[model samples]
Target: MNSGEVIDVTRDAIVTFLKVGGPMLVVALLVGVAISLLQALTQIQEQTLVFVPKILALAAAALFAMPFMGDAMASYMTRIAERIAGG
Candidate 1:
């Protein structure tokens, strides 16, 4: 592939990665921020209090987002394969 094609492929890979992982990360970040606020307000600083909810929220978000992730990966792979075959 030429430089332009290579850059395009790399950009697609990055976008796919962000599309797949971004939601859960965003959810975890939001949860952590909210938890921090709660801890500050209530003065409860147990580490598990932060860890467990973040994990649970991330898991739930990932589970909910799995279909979209799969679709995006499949779409990217198909485009890549087509480019390879054509080139």
Candidate 2:
């Protein structure tokens, strides 16, 4: 409830967010970079070429990462609820 508590909660929220979302983000970034490199090498400048692969990769990543993401979010929520109850 105080400034320190608020800072701690905010910091935890950010860490939880990164933990839950980092995999998909990294997947997206890597896919995008790879696609860009392939396009550069092949001289394929089609702007729409990146979408399908990135989408598929991100979907697969999300699917594989779902359980970990869920556990992280659940833990974060539990901690927040405990703090609230304690206060």
Candidate 3:
């Protein structure tokens, strides 16, 4: 592939990755921030307090978003495969 094709492929891959992971990452970040704020306000300096909520939130987000993520990745892979076959 040429440089332009390579760049397009790279961009598609990155976009696919972000699309797949963004929801869970955002949920985890929000949960972490909220937990941090609560900890600060309550002086509950327990590590698990912060970790557990974030983990749970991320897990829930992952579960909820799994179908969409799978579809996006599958579409991306199909596009990649088609490009390879065409080229």
Candidate 4:
């Protein structure tokens, strides 16, 4: 593929990746921040305390976002297939 097409595909792939992962990342970040604040207030410096909630938050976010992730990935793959077919 030419440089322009390669760049376009790369950009699309990155955008798709961010869209797919963004929700979970945001959830995890929020959970972490909240946990940190609670820990600060309670003076409980437990690493496990921070981790478990973050895990659960990320899991819930991933589950909630599964359909969106699938659709984004499918659309990206379809575009790739169309490009391949055209070439």
Q: Number of the top candidate by TM-score?
A: 2
Candidate 2 C-alpha error for residue 55, in Å: 0.6
- Which candidate number would show the highest lDDT if scored against the true structure? 2
lDDT of each: 0.93, 0.97, 0.90, 0.91
Question: What range of 10 consecutive residues in model 4 has the weakest lDDT sum?
Answer: 50-59
Q: Give the per-residue lDDT digits (tens) of candidate 3, residues 34-75.
A: 989998999999988787777778888888999999999999
Residue-level lDDT of model 4, residues 1-87, one tens digit each, is 999999999999999999998888888888888999999999998878987778777888888899999999999999999999999
RMSD of 4: 0.8
lDDT of 1 at 80: 97
Q: How many backbone clashes does candidate 1 have?
A: 0
Query: What would the TM-scores of all predictions be?
Result: 0.94, 0.98, 0.94, 0.95
The TM-score measured for candidate 1 stands at 0.94
TM-score of 2: 0.98
**How close to the true structure is residue 36 of candidate 2, measured as C-alpha lDDT?**
100
What clash count goes with each model? Answer: 0, 0, 0, 0
Clashing pairs in 3: none
- Order of all candidates by lDDT, from best down to worst? 2, 1, 4, 3
The superposed Cα distance between candidate 4 and the true structure at residue 44, in angstroms, equals: 0.7
Candidate with the larger lDDT of 2 and 3: 2
Ranking by TM-score: 2, 4, 3, 1
